[model samples]
Target: MSVPAHPRVTDVIETPVAAPARPRHRADIEGLRAVAAVLIAVYHIWFGTVSGGVDVFLLLTGFLITGSLVRAMERDGRIAFGAFWTKLVKRLFPAGAVVLGAVLVMTYLFFPRSQWMTVIDDVRAAVLYYGNWHLAAGSVDYMADNSAASAAQHFWSLAVQGQFYLLWPVLITLAGLVAVRLGVRVRRVAFAAVGIVFVVSLAYSLWITAVEPVWAYFDTGARLWELALGGMLALVVHRVDLPGTLRMIAGWLGLAGLVSCGLVIGDSLPYPGFASLWPTVAALLVILAGAGEAANGRFSANRLLGVRPLTWLGGHAYTLFLWHWPVLIVYLELTERVRPSLTGGLMVLASSFAAALFTTRVIEGSVNRVTKRHRAPSWSLAAGVIFIVPVLAAGSLWAHSIDQDRRLRLELSSNPLAYPGAAVHLNPELAAGLPDLPIHPDTTTVARETIDQTRSCNAVVEDTEVVSCEFGDPGSDYTIAMVGSSHVRHWFQAMRTLADQHGWRLVTMTKNACQFSSEEQVYRGEVYTECTAWNADVMLELAELTPDAVFTLASLTDRKEDEHVPTGFVDRWRLLDGMGVDVIAIRDTPRFDFPVPECIDRNGRDECSSPKAESMAEVPPFKDLPNVPHNTRFLDLTDSLCEDGVCHGVIGNQLVYYDTDHLSYAFSRSLAVVMEPQLLEAVGQAVPKGEPTLVDAAMTLHESAHS
Candidate 1:
């Protein structure tokens, strides 16, 4: 109720403000969907980057599904949950199943053997509608960008959409249940719940994107608000109407903004972050502008959007989205192309479009026809179950079989004669036939073998302080603190062997990407704030342990990109020297940008070697450290790993760098024969001499993995 307008305005009685008018038959929404689907597929192909189109789809899905379900419940007094869900499954699954099945066949025929297990694992996740989480766990991992890109990676959005389809209805049902119990309207209850989620999830997305972008990019929690924002618009638009002038402005602005969002945000942002509002808001305006027929005749965006071609694409959008990614991947792999040349990308796009058209028409239409013959909701529901169970089971069985196969390969690698490590360096004959074909350890294991080190001993990411894992003669009086990033940790196999022979206690206190230094280091694409703090904590702990000597790589390390000393190494050396802790600083090894196993598998040994000078950092030797005690010594071991200044991916029969930079455990262990003497000289300086190391030089441990 409004107070009577002030008497100053004259004595006209005021009336209640009416709600905006609602319109039906939004052909423009369909057109917007077509635009979004094309942008998403096109951007993914040509630019090889996200184009903010997925965010638009997420919102559109949220709004359409929520609005439809809410309207049905309101009109019929209760939802036909079984019928509703079955209809949705029928519309979506057949197309998705077609794509998955095709990809599986393609994987066997085309993808590298090393990628088989990873893609199969993703297949299971995709079928179960948790592909996003699976990807979040792997792709957003520490040093995650290093993993080989997967064809199924694009399934993450589809999975998010599928999960939302199941979850949102249940949420609405529960909201209705609560509303009845409290004697309030269901719409009010549902809206309140949705509004609450929007606030919480948006806040979480903002915070998580800022802190852990890898996780944020694929996290369901971080992306939920995008869908919810769409749902909210569905509710608002259903009850409100805008005048002609307003709709006209929104129509033109929304269309232009929708097409240009990718340009504004670019590829640098950790999105669906706060910047996501740009696309979602633009989509909302499009929906608003499309509410009813235009008052301005040809001026409205809806006129163009409602045209024939766009609406047609919108009808087949789901199939197109499903088909494009795998098609793109297969085309690239078969052509052995990277980031697709224009002609190749065009071929991929055309193939995807053709596949989409076929699946949507034949498989999708046929399934709908069969399901429609039965009007009973229960029959359709059972049919949906029958259709889904077998598909999911097939994925699970394939994943298990590949997992068992991988374990067998790893077990076989353990045999002394079977998998040589660095001995390949000593015997070039070992890598003779490997370079001519595709050979690799499980591509899935690359991250574990590289950054995470996969050993149960490494500290978790949450461990901000030093957490030590002991190895080799824990009771020994002489203690050696093995420290550095994953690069340093890769030497554990050799270090463990050396410590055993000398009766020395070995403690590993390293973190992912953490280097022992006083200078700031980068982590996850930003300044590595956590690494700097962790390094400080580690230095404090080493001071307390007062170990005989700290074994760590001392020189600046460079990979495919830049080279630099961890600016704080000098400060750290001075502090350690003052504490009487002598340092055994080893010159850092060369880093290869590409995976050695993958390279060696495809190319000859000669072709797989990286230039030594280009890969190595040019830091000064420890003679530059003015505070060095007489006991402190520096060692350069580059010659042992390189020949003629070119580093082989496989030296002897053993693979060198696992993925790109990190040495495999096997290769590092093979170096025990070489490392034993050098370490003996360094540790022998302080501790009473012990028995010599007994490593077999002929059977060098060669089992290594790469970055």
Candidate 2:
């Protein structure tokens, strides 16, 4: 490996394989760190934006650590991975633990019971790492953007960096060993190997971001190129002895690039792709500029970055990053404000700085100082203690929540009064049995019965093709096709009993958060291509199978009836009408910002009911949007679902909602009494007169095909 004459902080750790390199005390790099932290905090708090600050951090992580690994391998013919990791734990863990412990306390005091389980899970993921994967899976879910932001979401990057820290050493060790076997210089082999990773990973980033941008955002595989770019630079930067004037100009431009990041590159774009190169490369320029003394001269921007205030901020940058996000998200949720006012933003910034300064100085710096003076085992033991305490506390919280939820579910099944799912509709006498407050079978268990969580034939977000699930009586040839998204899927439970009793087959095709629309819908700021593709296939299949009638959602949630129909609803209605097929368009269930069931669980029934008129369209959307008048029938079960111009959270002793919008399976099934009659009336009215009813027509076609 080619060696740098100058020693640096990353190089100075006394691992067994480490050379006796002294600390370089690079002021410019520290200054860059300060700038990065400020930009990220400013964007997160006030701008409500992404500024590519995480991109810079990824680059710096690879740049700083790779130099030391190379030096260690050269000095001892191998890297001492254990000592290297121990040094990182000492530098990173204490501040993170202090902030997480504080977040837990604040969460208990300020957050609602509805959000408790969410934050607890995030806290655990934050402590253990894998928060990024947890978040990626959630980000595209039907319920993803509906909830408030998680306080610990930024731990995703920290998790990514931690993963990189573990994996990089192994990769570098292998590269070094292979190079030795091949008689090639270790630096040449390492750079080439990392460069290959950079190209392949960048291509994967582009593809995944294009297809599924939400997952791409936090995916470690998609982000590998940014860190690999830094590794490649570490291999080549020492050889770049640029002219003093050119180096000075380059440093100034780099600083300008970093400052302009948010403005030049929009926050909406999927990142860690080609656009990320701008920030990573800009950070590289500054790192490279100050590689020697000439780039830190009066003319260079490195001199400005090396100023006292920035250096001080840079010194505590890690802690600041840890403290700022939770501080901002918790403050936003508690205040019930979307973003802060000018004064509030200042308070948030001041609060973050105060927390960061304390955690870093009292806990982190002290741990680093003590660990430096002590042996690796002492620091390792201390790190374990720091991490374990929070985990035990978080685990206890989770355990209690689980036990409580299970009790609630048990009460639902065992107690007749508590578990009167659909009885309010069956016997008017039992209507008096429904309790008005404090329902059992809490929101979490009810939420599990949602189509998304149950993972029945309901296709999840990742599905790209039609997955048809059959319900109802198989003995009947009278099939009804249910299409669109989860909004339509919730109707399954209501219609399942009706279909079997009526001797109709129900074929359902649904996807998560992806309603059928002729105009492409957006997911994570990109075209929901999978949705477009799946909808196309479903439309094609339904056209061929021309069932008795198609049942689907007829209105968008939270919009006036006349304003819109789903973008493609009209087109599909026309096609089906052309095939002499009818559509039973169900006016969608009402939506709420607060889940009524969870609200009832935490608050009383009186406080939890949503207004009837405001929750759904003032009129059915398809009523105003043109559709096949004779062939399309509109079903509004809203009356049975609501009463007294108000919607009850629990109807017929069934929790109305699993989450904010979707119907609980129990509640929807209960609606079958109210639904089946209206379903018959609407669908019967839509079938063209003189045409054989679907049952007669289907049987004739089958008999003829067999004959």
Candidate 3:
């Protein structure tokens, strides 16, 4: 792949491997830092967008630190790992601790007890540098559901960078030692190391972009390359000499590119993949332009960067980065709105800046100044650990507390729609009770056999059960498969009921967010490896069985436009349609208008009922456009599920949904009545009419389940 060419400036200066003792400051570098901070703030504030700006910062961080470390190593003939770790601890920990502590305090005050657990868990994950994994597991259908606004969500990036720092120095030192042993210069080894990591990271980026874009966005595996690019630039900085005029052009263009990246990239882009090169390359240009003899020049360096306001803001950028996101998230949670109007946006921005300034001056500044001047290396390290450890412990304890509370509440609350005389029926009693129903003897017997077979399907896959089920009969003639992501699994209870009534053998081959398409990878983290393999095995297995019918909720094709997931519903339909098997595509239900967990916590269970027609009255039409292709028959229950242009709370007096989006078992069972005609039509087969006995049997089963 070609590195997109940009205009270059030239100036030549040769210096020894060791940097001078004097502290070197460049106006352009500070300007670049200001540029980066502004771009990210603008992107988050107005766009709520994901761009490569974060990656750009990672690269700049790598370049600056690596350049300093290499020069220090050359002077001393050995790197002081202890001193390096101490400086990093002092630079990062104080601001991070203050912001985290503040966010926790705010969370305790405004957030509901129900939400506190997840917040606590997120805090713990952030502290442990594993927030990315926590997020990746929940990545599927992420757009449809709103997240509880949390300040700590943004810390995942900071954690990623911190993790990189933790490991990179050791690797660099090892490479340096090997280079000396082999008679290769340290600079050359550094260059090679950067190049190797960059190539591997890029390859990983492309693979994840195709398979698991969400994981690719967060995973350190695919992101290290951006930092490596900066490290490589640091190693070669002394070797390149650009002329004055070219240097000036490069500096301005670099600034222009940085600004453009913020403005032009929308929320829909596949981030941190190829798109990230924009900001990373721009930062590199700015760094290169400021290098060499004329480090402070008219075009390459400017008095504007050194102006009091810019420099002051630049000095507090760390605190600002920490403070801004949580404040915005918390404010949104309290207000119940996210997209602020002009005035609201300004308020958020101003408040964020004020908090950032306060935290920086009052907490971070004092700690850093005192630590740097007087603290020993071991003491500084201990202080950093002490500050971070409490937040992690608190977060973990909070998560556990929330889980216990929810379980207790659920146990105490009466089932809102539980019928007056309904009793839990065991399998043998249910089988015995079937004889009193008015139905054909043949159909009844078949239904009973199907019910017995499905008992094994629902059996929890323990060690022994797994082995037994592995070789269980992959039944033919009556096989019905349920396939898709976890969203589809939400409907399984209803489907299982119908399968029992119809005497159909049901099989489930589902993954959390994976589509049934033959794509290589889906989702993020190590889970994608398992999800992809599972999907492939399921598809191949299904092909062998050639089941009677395969059912799944309609594909969320709109996410394709945003590059959120690879395969669309139309693609999946086409693949199944070509296989000479019947495919049933069920339309997805409406998501709650507000964030579910937060709304439930705030308003109590009364306000947490199934979405009714009145609740969705204001939602725009065309938001749920039926975009599936003509080859597939789209099954929409919107009318049956809603009434008077608003979906009602019930199907025949049983609540229609389990949560905000999933259909309740009772409701799905009732849906067989509304769905029977369309299902018969799609199957292109007719119920054998004898004495109306089968219809009576089906209706009786449906009513029993719903009642």
lDDT of 1 at 239: 49
Question: Candidate 3: lDDT over CA atoms?
Answer: 0.60
Best by lDDT: 2
lDDT, each prediction: 0.72, 0.74, 0.60
In the range 280-334, model 2's lDDT, one tens digit per residue, is: 8899888888875455888788888899999999988888898888888777876
* Candidate 2 vs candidate 3, TM-score winner: 2
Greater-TM-score candidate between 1 and 2:
1
Write the residue-wise lDDT of candidate 3 on 18-137 in tens digits. Answer: 444533576555666666676676667666775456776788788877777666555555666787887777677766876787778888998765355456666777776776667665
The parts of candidate 3 lying over 4 Å away from their true place are: 1-23, 50-52, 111-115, 140-149, 239-241, 299-303, 369-374, 413-480, 484-487, 494-505, 511-543, 546-592, 595-597, 607-659, 664-707
Inter-residue clash pairs, candidate 3: 9-246, 9-247, 10-242, 10-243, 11-242, 11-243, 151-326, 613-646, 613-647, 642-647
lDDT of 1 by residue, 345-388 (tens): 78878888899999888887776777678767665565455656
Clashes of each: 20, 1, 10
